[model samples]
Target chain A: MIIAVASGKGGTGKTTVATSLALVLGNRAQILDCDVEEPNCHILLKPTILTTDTVNLPVPSVDLEKCSLCGKCGEVCQFSAIVLIGKTILTFPELCHGCGSCSILCPEKAIREIPRNIGVIETGFVKDLDFVQGRIRIGEAMSPPLIREVKTKINRDKIAILDSPPGASCPVITTVKNTDFVIMVTEPTPFGLNDLEIAVEAIKGLRIPMGIVINRSDIGDSSARDFCNNNGLPLLMEIPHHRKVAEGYAQGAPLIESMPGYGHKFKKLSDDIQMIISESYEGASI
Target chain B: MKIAVTSTGKTIESAMDPRFGRAPYILIVDDNCNLIEAIDNSANVNAFRGAGIQAAKAIADRKVDMLLTGRCGPNAFTTLEAAGVKVGIEQSGTVREAVERVKKNEVSIADKPNAEAHW
Candidate 1:
C-alpha cells in the first residue's frame, strides 16, 4: 500500500514519522522523499545513493531559421511563454510549462522541445529499506514536476511511504495523490490546527482515508484533538515532546533507534495502518 | 505617438498604478496628452501566473508606442521591448501628469527591467 505522510505546516515532524515508520517496516517498505524543495529525510535516513538521474523538463526552443512569424505558436500558447512581436518571435523558457502546444499548433513548426534540467532524483537504500528522493535545483519555482518524478520511483511490491512537502498547495497535492492512505502530522497548536483543517479539506476532496499523528502532543492546546474528535477523524498516534527525541533528531538519528521502546510504538502504528487498509478493502468488497 | 499608462481607475485623472502586470487600468493617450480610452486590466490581477506577459500583450495589442508604469518585470519588459515599445519606469502621480511627464521627456525610457518578477 502506498501511504503518504504530509503536514500543512512546515517542521511538524513529517520526516520524523516517515523515517521512523520506514525503519519499523524494514525491508518491507520503501520511503520516497517527495519534498523536492528541501528534502530532510535524507538527513535522517542517510541512504547511500546507488543511482542518480537528472530530471529535465521539455521547454520550447525556437528555430529562427525555419521561422515564419505567423503568430500561430504565440496565439496557441496559453502561458504567454512565446509571443510574436512584429517579425520577431520571443520565447521565455522560464514561463513555459512545456505543454508543447506551441510546437504542435505552430503553422511554421519553428518550435522544438529542448530538455532543461530542473532537478535530480536519487535512488538508494537505507539498510534493507529502499529509499528515493528528488531535490529541485535552487531558484526553481516548480516542485510538482520533480515530485511527480520521485513518485515514479515507487516500488509497487513494497509498502511505499511518501514524505510530502508542507502546505496544501500543488506540490503537496502531487505528492499525496493516488496514495492508499495519508498520515497528516501536526503539532497541537492553533496554527497547526488551522493548517491541518485546510489540509483535511484538501484530503477530503481527494477522498483519501487519512488519520492525524499529533507531534509534540503534550505542549500545545488540545484543540487538534478536539477538532479531530468533532470531525470524527481518527487520531492514529501521538509523539510526545521529549528532550532525548529532539537531540536524537538533531543528531540525525532515527527515532526507532534513539528512543527506547519507540520501535514497538512505530510497529504498532504500522500494524494499525494495515488494519485500516484491510478493513477499508473488506468494506469496499462488501 | 499613442502611450499606455498603468492607472488605478478608468480616467486620465486617476492615480497612476505602480504595478505594471496587475494594474487595474491601462489609460491610452494620444501624442497631444489627450485621453484616448481606458482599457480595464483587472483580468490579469488574479492571473494564476504570467500576469506580466498577459498584461504586456494586452497593452501591446492597443498598438501603443510607449508604456509608463512604476515597475516592469523581466518577462513583460522583454515582450514590450521586442514589440518596439519604449518603457518609462518609476512613473507616478495622476495619469495626466504621467502623460505630461512623458511628453516633456521627464521620464526616460528604461534600459532594462526595473523590478524582478514578484510571482
Candidate 2:
C-alpha cells in the first residue's frame, strides 16, 4: 500500500514519523519525500544515494521569424504566458504551464517547448529501505511537475511510504494524490485543529481514507482525539514529546533505528494500516 | 524608483487591488521592507514559491533601497535583507498615497500572521 504522511502546517514531525516507518519496514517498504521546498527525510535516514536525476519543466520558446500578429496563443493560455502585440508575441516563460495548446494552435508554429530545469530527484538505499525525493530550484515558480517526477521512483512491489509537504495547497495535493492511504500527523493546538479541519475537508473531497497520528501527544489537549473519534477515523499512533527524540533527530539518527524498541511500534502501525485497508476493501467487496 | 505592486486587476487603472482593494496601484512604499521595485507582486495569488526573488527583482530593478506597503513574509523578508533592502510594513492606500507615506515616514513594517494575501 502507498501511505502518505502529511500535515496542514509545518514543523509537525511528519518527516520523523515517515523516516521511522521506512526504517522499520526495511526491504518491505520504499519512501518518497515529496516536500521539494524543504525535504528533511534524508537528513535523518542518511541513505547512500545511488543515482540523482534533474527534473525539468517545459517552457515555451517563441520563434520570432515566422510569428504573425495572431493572439490565439495568448487567448488560449489560462496563465497569460503568451501575449501577441501588433507584430510581436511576448512570452513569459515563468508563468507558462506548458499545456502545449499554444504551439498546437499557432498558425505559424512559432512556439516550441524547451527544457527549463526546475529541480533534482535523488534516489538511494539505507539498508533495505529505498528513498527518493525532489528539491525545487530556489527561484522557480512551479513545483508540482518536479514532485511528480520524484514519485516516478515508486516501486510497486514494495510498500511506498510518502513523506509529503505541509499544508493542503497544490504541493501537498500533488504529493498525496491517488495514494492508497494517508496518515496525517498533527499536534493538539487550536492552530493544529483548525488546519486539521481543512485537511479533513480535502481528504474527504479526494475520497482517500486517512487516520490521525498526533505528535507531541502527551503535552497537548485531547482535542485531536475528540476530532478523530467524532469523525470515525482511527488514532493510529501517538508519539510523546521526548527530548531524546529531538537529540536523535539533530544527530541524524532515525529514531526507530537508534532505539531498537521503537521499531516494534512502527511495525505495529504498518500492520494496523494494512488491516484497516483490508477491512475497507472486504466491506466494499461484500 | 520602480516598485513591486500586488493587485488583482491588470494595468494602472480599473484595478481590484488585493492590498488596498480599490486603489489603481499601490507600490510598497519604503520597499526596503519588502526589496521589490514594482508593487505588482503576484506571489500570493499565483505562485507556490520564489516570491522573494521575483518580487524583489521587480523593485530592485528600479534601484529601490526601501520596501513599502502591506505584509512581509519570511522568505521575501530574508531575500530582501540579503540584498541589503529595508522592509517597511502595514500599508493600505493608493500607490501615490503610499509613496507620500514613505516620504513622510508614516508607515511602519510588521510581520503578517499568514504568509500572504491578508484580505
Candidate 3:
C-alpha cells in the first residue's frame, strides 16, 4: 500500500511523520521522498545512496536547415517556450513542458527533442528500509515531473510512504495522486487550519481516504480538532509539542530513534491507517 | 509610429498600469498622440498561466512599434524584443501623459528585462 504524507502549510511535520513511520515499518517499508524542491527526509534518514541517475526533460531543438519558419510551432506552444521572431526561431528549454507538441506538429519535421537535465534521483537504503528521493536542480521552476520520476521507484512488495511537498498546488497533487491513503499533517494555528481545509478539499476531490495528524496538537486553538470532528474525519495521531522532539529533529534524528518509545506510536498510526483502508473497502462493496 | 500603453481603463484618463502581462487594457495611439483605441486585455489577465507571453503576443499582433509599461518580465521582454518592439519601462501617470512622454522621448527604452519571469 502506498501512503502519502502531506501538509498544506510548510513546517507541519510531514517529513517527521513519514520518516518515523518508515522507521517503525523497518524492512517492510520503502520510502520515496517526492518533495523534490526541498527534500528534507534525507536529513533524518541519511541513507547511504547506492545509485544516482540524472532526470531529464526532452525539449525541442530546431533544425534551421530543414525548417521553414512558418511559426506554427510558436503558435501551438502555450508556454511561449518557442517563438518565431521574423526569420529567427527561438526555443526556451526552461519553459518547455516536454509535451512534444512542437516537434509533432512541425510541418517540416524540423524539430527534434533533446534531453535537458532538470534533477537527479538517488536510491539508497537505511538498514533494511529502502529509500529513494528526487533532488530538483536549483532555480528549476517545475517539480511535478521530478516527483513523478521518484514515484517510478515505488516498491510494491513493501509499504511505500511518500513525503509530499507543501501547499495544495500542482506539486502536491502530483505526489499524492495514486496513493492508497493520504496522511495530512497539520498544526493548530489558524493558517494551518485554513490551508488544511484547502488540502482536504483537494484530497476529497481525488476521492482518496484521508486522515489528519495534528502536529503540536496542544499549542493552538481547538478549531482544527473541531473542524475534523464536524467533517467526520478520523484524527489519526497527535504529536505533542515537546522540546526534546524539537532538539532531536534539529539534530537530524528521527523521532522514533530519539524519543525511545515513540516507535510504538508510529506503528499504531500505520495500523490505524490499514484498518481505515480495509473498512472503506468493505463499505464500498456493500 | 503606433505605440501601446498598458492601462487600467479604456480611456486616455486611465492610469498607466505598472504590470504588463496582467494589465486590463492596452491604450493604442499614433505618432500625433491621438487616441486610436483601447484594446481589452481581460482574457490574458485572467489566464491561469502564460499571461505575460499571451499579453505580449496580443500587443505584438497589433503591430505596435513600442510598448509602455511599468515592468516587463524576461519571457515577455524576449518575445517583445524578438518581434522588434521597443519597450519603455517604469511608465506611470495617465495613458495620455504616457503617450506624450513617449512622443517626447522622455521614457527610457529597456535593453534587458527589469524583472524575472512570472513577475
Evaluated against the true structure, the overall lDDT of model 2 is 0.73
**Positional deviation of residue B6's Cα in model 2 after best superposition, in angstroms:** 14
For residues A114-196, what per-residue lDDT tens digits would candidate 3 score against the true structure? 99999999999999999999999999887889999999999999999999999999999999999989999999999999999
Error of 2 at B79 (Å): 25
**Which residue pairs clash in candidate 1?**
none
Question: How many backbone clashes are present in model 3?
Answer: 0
Tens digits of per-residue lDDT, candidate 1, A1-286, equal 9999999899999999999999889999999999999999999989999999999888888898898778888778877778877777888877778788998887778888999889999999999999999999998887888998899998999999999999998999999999989999999998999999999998898878889999999998999999889998889999999999999999999888789689898888999988988888888899
What lDDT would each prediction earn against the true structure? 0.90, 0.73, 0.91
RMSD of each: 1.6, 9.4, 2.4
The candidates, ranked best first by DockQ, are: 1, 3, 2
Writing each residue's lDDT as its tens digit, candidate 1 over B7-107 gives 99988889999999999898899977788988888888888667888888777777889999999999999889878889999989998899899768899
Best model number under lDDT: 3
* Candidate 1 vs candidate 2, DockQ winner: 1
Instruction: Identify the CAPRI category of the predicted complex in candidate 1.
Output: medium
Reference-based TM-score of each model: 0.95, 0.73, 0.91
Candidate 3 local Cα displacement, residue B103, angstroms: 4.6
| Worst ten in a row by lDDT for model 3 chain A | A79-88
Candidate 3 interface CA RMSD, Å: 2.1
